[model samples]
Target: MILTFFDQFAIPHLLGFPLIIPAMLIPLTFFPTTNRLAQNRLSTLISYTSKTITKQLMLPLSQKAHKWTNPLFSLMLMLTMLNLFGLLPYTFTPTTQLSINMALALPMWLMTVLTGLRTQTTTSLGHMLPEGTPTPLIPMLIVIETISLFIRPLALGVRLTANLTAGHLLIQLISTATLTLFPMSYTLTALLGTVLILLTLLEIAVAMIQAYVFVLLLSLYLQENI
Candidate 1:
């Protein structure tokens, strides 16, 4: 049997952020021109499985800003698939691993910085400081914004890693205890098992939300600097 290193609070790094490379590639697999077109078709099938709904039920386009959201949505979908895949019995959730999240977030943070710098505005860093402040206050706000900027990546890493880790561990503990302590009377254990399965689905949703949150904030920050 493959051993899990963490009962809880295990360092998430040794899991190898290798998860990122696969996450990045999942969307590319959907490109029809690629050799992975079969995977792409399968993804589309799963994504649009509510075939009972006709075109009449669909809503019209609201705004061009919608295009900006595609990359974020794609990332979310990929991570959600990864999360769901890990929900299989005896599997591990890479989304629960900190190293994977940090790997994802650090690139986003750097991209924000690079995009902001490339689109330099006359406003300068000075303008981002609060208005009508003393010279000392100026440095303070700059320092605060700078720190906040860095915190974006940290928050992204913590949010995904912690949520996934906690959810998986809770499910594991409940399932294990059920098997061990209530071996004979299995109804309650079965109910709890069902609840845990539902929670894994919820975790998949949460992973998508986190991806959108990361990209939306990063874009907003870049817009401001631009």
Candidate 2:
């Protein structure tokens, strides 16, 4: 039995061996099966779905920013797969950790900011102080804008981490309660089981949506820069 709810978030172990390597490798399974001239139904479906999603994602982006399409699409798929992997009976989710999310967020965010600064120097700095600002309030407004600018990556990381963590915790809580109540009342346990199933389904949707959101927001940030 798990000693604590948080322990489940920890790298699991078996016979005193940590499963971190396997956990890390699980995401590799998320990639497309193969690159063959002729494909089966599953491969065809994956191809169509990816094309559709990437097409929508790229719509708002300029041609100059179209280069980001692959990275953003891959990220969407990776996060979606990783999150879904965690829903299984035994698996760890790296995205649940703020550090990992930050590692993903900060670099992409930095790249966009850097791209903006390099290509549109005047425009980038102009964002800090809008065209018509009272002289006295300019200092305070600049400080606020700078703070907001730096907070973007942190917000991105925290958002993904918090959502997944909360969902996992709730699922664990409900599952535990269902097990505990099994002996007491068949009706109640069955009801809890039903709720658990529905919650899992909702979490599945959340997993996909959150991945899309992360990629979408990054694209929006890129849009502002490029």
Q: Which candidate gets the maximum lDDT versus the true structure?
A: 2
lDDT of 2 by residue, 22-75 (tens): 776778865654875246888888779989999999998899999989999988
Cα shift from native, residue 142, model 1 (Å): 2.0
- Computed on alpha carbons, the lDDT of every model, listed in order, comes to 0.60, 0.89
Model 2, residue 44: what's the lDDT?
81
Model 2 lDDT at residue 123:
90
Q: Once superposed on the true structure, which residue ranges of model 2 sit more than 4 Å away at CA?
A: 1-3, 13-18, 30-32
lDDT of 2 at 203: 96
Give every collision pair in model 1: none
What total of clashing residue pairs does each candidate reach? 0, 0
Off by over 4 Å in 1: 1-71
Residue 86 error, candidate 1, Å:
1.6
TM-score for every candidate vs. truth? Answer: 0.66, 0.93
**lDDT, model 2:** 0.89
